[model samples]
Target: MERSQEYENTAWASPVCDAQEPRLAAAISGRRLPCFGRARPKKIAEGVGSLNVRSMTGRSREVADLMKRRKINILCVQDTRWRGNKAIDNWEMGTSSFFSRANKEGREGVGVVLNAEWKKHMVNVNRCSNRVMSIKLMYGKVTINIISAYAPQVGCSIEEKEDFWEQMDAQITWMGEEERIILGGDLNGHVGRNRNIIERTHGGWGVGERNEESENVVDFAVAFDMAILNTFYKKQENQMWTYCSAGRKSQIDLLMCRRNNLKEIKNFKVINGESVAPQHRLIVIDFEMKEERRGRQQQTSRIKWWMLKDQELKAEFKIKVLDRMVEAEDPDTWWTTSSRHIIEIGEEVCGKTSGKDPSPPRIRNLGVE
Candidate 1:
């Protein structure tokens, strides 16, 4: 069946409980939470996803299946409600899960799931709190920080909301300027379709109308020089809503990244037809690593200098180069013509090298001799 059709037929189940209110008392009392386990490598994903699973208590298999079917490499999950800080490996499914939750059960929690390919690249996991968690991966020379957050809902107190934003601010500030970040969460706010004062952070393709809570989201983006990636793409009306319940819908789930890295995002939108979470749908963004792309181009453009060792090929290349290097009017023109002809003829005769050296140099030990 079509995904959208399945979505229409699937029954929307009410959440077992409302979103956990920000635990203001603990924050006020200065109580320290246990640090989550740290896991270790880094390869950035082509497709990254975010979903508020509502409660991931018994849905590990289901979540893994969904990720595999959708080809999602990394997933940021909110409201995991999985107590304790540890890593869960589903070897059969080829995915790794890590979570951070409140001491109490059935409350705010967040986690990140990485496919087997990316799992090896995970360098660290920071279970910042029950409401926010992050994982860092090394992708070539770039460090990617993927944060999963669950903010206070509208019913939560102002202080609680403030605390959540403060934690988010601290998390982003702690990251070095050279690092890249992809923050995904059920922030529970409507950024709306208007960019206005927040044009630098908002893409203006959002749904619904702006509210105070969403204003905080926009303000956070602006302050951190991040862009709300979800709002940058135009999608079907149904595909624009991330949260749906009781005949009401809103685009509260969001994915964000640094504004300067916006060009790396190729596509971002809601994924309908999944019933993993009855109330919240999955949203994904497709991005490419700029360094990886450049590396591939550089490798493919390298000349096959090793082939020059062949006497016949070398003679042919020399003749072709001499034919193309006609006398020029000036010294500058002559040098340019000579260099270009040499390179062009060399490539034509010997061809370009593959990504790697076909024959590596051999090492010899002279001590024994």
Candidate 2:
């Protein structure tokens, strides 16, 4: 009976109970077990959207409200038709809107809007041209570049289309490999539902038939190693289309991101029943930004060894430790058992020091006084 009780009280019994009653094992062994309930790494879920507002003349508040209602963090609006290159902050709506437009009104214009949460992280805004503009934001260690573009329509001259692509190519080529890029725009082209030759850039979920303008979009994606997000998700015709006009529907507005970052995208779809614009619907993509975990500094506690100077306390500790002592077959077991008992008894007899610097002893200056 004595040997059985001794064995049950030793560290050997801890392993069996550790799997079942971890708290009980920890108490019996006088050691703390690792906690498995640590919090998971945090992730930032951001919704980036694109819309052709047609004209954002007196509808800034309306656009801001739409963004807030839909929980969109970043929005790229094309054909804003706002003159000059400047930024507008709507305090009541909690959005920062930036636009780049031609000197004349009612013409080509592009803009990007950020919610209050993302506005503080904005590094700079590049107004490349009336048809293209970009905003750079620092998200932890990653740099996110969001470009808003308005490509020329089929009715426009060949030179106008070429110029727009040239500007887009320049902007894309300027971005570094490590930076994350999300291009949203009204490219006014259809990539179609086929993924035969351009499968690397097109995701095969596109709508309608490919056109001449579609080649420009696909070739750009292939050259830059980007994935056209609109053609990646399978959705119904209504959910897939971004534009609706005089008895016609099309998916002209599009979103694109780096091919390597496709895994970060969670969902992409067009929002229906939204009346932000008469012809265009809002298309959004949900993606996650993983926050880097910071290393924690280990905290240590120091035992108050000097408390043993109290003769009565030291005697009590020694007696308690001697009472708990037991013979062990091995040196390791003997040392561990003896040390644990000694430390336990010492803690009971003499308290520990707080992990802080103690006040200095009063200085004696009898001679100086």
Candidate 3:
């Protein structure tokens, strides 16, 4: 299931969808994500209603699982080295994405993705960093802007850090104050290892002064009044640290909204397996979506597949497939709660349904054991 990033397969994304991906075989070749976190935004759109955010830590298979979970809507990643021409279906039943991969074939790049059907409503503005993707969303005719960002390693000099801060300042200001904005990603900066009480502002960790680059991000967040939800980690000891590095841990990846109604972080394995080879864990964000597709509609694409016969028009049929799966027989046999758990990804849909009395599922045909 290993895919490549190149001039062709523009819609191609990460390699984390399949466990068979050669990249994750750490014992095989080069550093899995050596040039991962340095790319810039490649594609964009407006109205990204909901998303599943994560610092991929260079695993595409996990990215695919997150897509299938029906929990988070969009995903943000960092350090995705040499990612291009990767397959979306291989990751999830129905999923499509946009991404900026490592710049030098095995180095740095960045990208973003919206289910094709939802693309028309949103538009993306270009900036620096495969680390950042800005989406303009229209909620009930109300516009909301979101920026998915990732800062660089704190190894740069103070002068260089100042320059990055200036650029970050300009990009954020460009969003303007009129619209609602939610900015999330891995800042890679923390106040300190210990969650000490902050007298001034910010609840959780702040960026460290490893170098000037990180200091700039920390200072900017404080100046902008961006609330760090993970600050409340002390409130919920169970949820902390989106990634574990060198055996030490810290909450590097973040999810910050303009207005904080931060309910609860979904789970660690939202889009990944239970292994730790990639070095990072998955993070999911769940908030109210502005709008939901009410009925069946038509969509066209350039992708090809077993279901899509047309050479030009490609349609995501995952939703339709799951709907049928649920209605096949004693719905309760293969269902848990409700069919509302549908995840309409790129070209397909997959999800677990809930029934009144949920006790997992007991399916014989599909081998539910």
Candidate 4:
């Protein structure tokens, strides 16, 4: 048994279990494990976090370490600032990274980091543009589509913002109906506190006042039936704000999931102690995923019948069969036991045949079958 350790100054909760101390879902090893910063285990969702890392090239290893310690299985990162699409599988990081970037300039990029276990379940990756990327993961029968997006900033043109939403919607529409969507990144919008209370999708826990971009984001979520996860959970003022500066603090980075999936997601909050991005804090969400059960496989073996054609092989097999037959208690027992003995001796005399049709019918001047 592994000893459990405790950490201070960190809060944890799960909406699904409604427990004071949220429990993490089981790990790949079939063992229940606790998260680093929080103790007390209750059944909670797999950890998925979003961080505006600003740039990921030189800090990939550092970010991976932070995620591993935090027990995050999958992470969506924005503002990568890379210039192309690439997947990083470094041993030191102990995580796999897939990123999509602009073709011209190193701006407005998005990426995803999956732990080693989760990477094996990845079905496919689609890099639509620098601002949009989707990765489909198969957990048994369930196919979950996780999209990482970097929306246009408040200063960007109206045409650019419209284009970004259009592109983002296109990606969502492209997915299959059964596939679950977990979209997260720097949406560059604040849904605010008061209006969120009145909205169906918003849970009234948002920070600050709404801006034009915030209205756009809320409208987009309402149109798509996605629930703003950050607005659903109550947390401290600092924990609600994803972006902070010397004089200004705002809630721009957000995590959005299909409104139907709101129940599966437990806790959503911001971690301010992270050092990856000075302006943006790491936002973490916990949700549960169903794991498939595997059944045991049967064992089998084959005998080489072609070896019987050889006289020497026949003589060896006969001797072994007779020896085994003499040791048997009865005629019926001898018939059952001697057959395997004959094959065992024949294998020593002549090699076993390959599982395939050992001698395929030779086709001369082959034509269409």
Candidate 5:
């Protein structure tokens, strides 16, 4: 519903049916749904859900708090004031950050950040326009492609936008079909504008209706096999608006990706914050990445088994368990009775050293078999 509301600035045709929106694969139209800032306010909770936002400047602390409290996994920002030296320096500890904001002089900008845990997989880094940057992630076999963008404003004209995509598309073409490509940021084009088109997620599976340039962009995404996430609001009053300049609100900011790739899109909502917060609310979304489950399982099992071994082998473990205890020349590093199970390792070692059978044992003289 709110997805269509971005058209409020101009009159739009009757909305398209949900089954007719653009599809990455012809038969998978249903895979696409209302995207961030496109779905209606009612479709999503006001201030709760996972999210990635654009344009958070001088607000790293507040953003960090929000991420920790909400556990946000990814963040893409555009026009953030972050600059050369101080950009990464100011980030909250424990967050992996990639930023390309306006240079110290402040011309144009873009950036991205993720949970610090994601640092392991950071792969490709691309900077386009002063306002765009693309990052590739590899989590084992799973890949995530994220881009932060700031499209040109009205004064910049459609040609600028046309040029913008030309360069961007050229840069990211190496991405794989299976990769999850997300392009989001301060896309200045308004919903349903002559150049900014709004279409339904269900019907014809192509851009709903376009002026000329709009359709071209849509065509490119389709050619690239990308799906534009749809919205919940029906282009009516129950809006999914993001900008409120001149006392008129409209949808602008957006998050997009291959339609079928989002595992389970629980929903999308706008978090209306305090007056001090940006007028554009945070568009929170809940999506499960099915592909990540396997690696997560492997990591969990690996870590569980690893730490388990490390703990049981404490008698031989050189790593200090407690900092204060390290200086004490502790008699037994792994001797905690709580961890008596590790006794098997010690007994095996002892039995071998004393020339005793390993399996002959009674509990009292464990070293002997």
Candidate 6:
């Protein structure tokens, strides 16, 4: 189960469905349909993605850009191969907590990157080792613990893998019932397609045969009551495989969440294109949070009175106002109407505000006018 290099086979098979004729026609006519089992719009769904960048030294910014285009809120990074245990900020990419080798060349590093919106909620980061790292973020009323890890390959010693799982178990035990947990990264194991036997964790949509490593992954999930998220949704072969090598493909990199929160997961699939990492495709899952955000306060933009400072623009505004309000009955309504028309003319003559308008300040216990 060691991570393999790039493979040769990149061919994709057509989806098997009743409407294959139209889909095939569309394919032939150079039109592409959305991926199978892709979720439509959801009221509470939030996009989270994971990718093994192999090395995140110079490519972190590119990966962040890809996530932005895909609308990923939080992304788990693995195999960063960075040298330190400090946080790296790429400005546009937001902030990444890199936990890597403290001594020699960094390998098997893990990191977590949050979008600008989520970065403010980040509290503390725990760098357990080069193989494991965790970040805590407060989302409204609930706390979310996101653990990013890179598991040992099958060739590694059993003690190493066991110790890794033990660390993970300890991390999970640290969380309370109210706090949510998401453990994701390159586990380097296949959970297989036998959902009936492993009903507690596997979702029956996994490909390939089960092996000893797969058993290890399954045992870890079963012990912690977590579900392998990628297996829940049906997808094309290309969309299921997270790693490809030598015409061989496998679903090793995965995302797991508490079994109780499994219902919130709307879609999980391997995304194609945006190939920042050639070996691994991004895995994005959409899930709804328990808390809904409050409605935004209503407000109107202020008129651009600065435009009137220019003499030429002031003359233009005067001419437009005169033409629109020369003859008006009802003086009060005419003044109000004329003001709006004059403001429109001023805005057209010059530009409006440059930055985004924030919500108006809330007043505390103030009487209405």
Clashes of each: 5, 0, 63, 4, 26, 1
Q: Considering summed lDDT, which 10 consecutive residues are worst modelled in model 6?
A: 22-31
Clashing residue pairs in candidate 4 (N, C-alpha, C atoms within 3 angstroms): 23-42, 45-287, 45-288, 46-287
Name the regions of candidate 2 deviating beyond 4 angstroms.
1-41, 91-93, 291-369
TM-score for candidate 1, residues paired by index: 0.66
Cα-lDDT of candidate 3:
0.47
- Model 6 score (lDDT): 0.76
Identify the superior model by lDDT, candidate 2 or candidate 4. Answer: 2
**Cα-based TM-score, every candidate:** 0.66, 0.68, 0.50, 0.66, 0.55, 0.65
Tens-place lDDT digits, model 2, residues 238-327 = 788888889888888999999988988889989888777978999999998666455665555556666666666678787888889999
In angstroms, how far off is 64's CA in candidate 3? Answer: 2.5
| Ten-residue stretch with the least lDDT total in model 2 | 22-31
Query: Of the candidates numbered 3 and 5, which has the greater lDDT value?
Result: 5
Q: How far off is residue 318 in model 1, in Å?
A: 54
- Report the C-alpha lDDT of model 1 over 1-369, residue by residue, as the tens digit: 699898878756655455544442322222354334422112257699999988877888888888889889899888877667757775444565554555366587888888888887789888778898898998777889999999999999999999899999989989999788999999988989988988878888888898888878988998999999988888877889998899999989999999988988889978888888989999999887655333333334567766777777778888888777688789998998788888888788877756576454533432322
Alpha-carbon deviation at 332 in model 1, angstroms: 57
User: What residue runs in model 5 are displaced by over 4 Å at the alpha carbon?
Assistant: 1-57, 84-90, 96-98, 157-159, 193-220, 230-239, 274-277, 292-369
> Per-residue CA lDDT of candidate 6, range 152-239, in tens?
9989998999998888888888888767788888998887777766787888888878767877789889988998998888877678
Q: Residue 166 in model 4: shift from native, Å?
A: 0.2
lDDT, ranked from best to worst: 2, 1, 4, 6, 5, 3
| Cα displacement (Å) at residue 348, model 4 | 61
Q: lDDT tens string, model 5, 160-241?
A: 7778778667756877776777776666544343223333222232222332434444564556655444343234333456
Prediction 4 global C-alpha lDDT: 0.78
The digit string of per-residue lDDT tens for model 3 on 106-186 reads 443344444544444565545464445566766455455656565665664667555545656766787756555666666
Best by TM-score: 2
By lDDT, who's the top model here?
A: 2
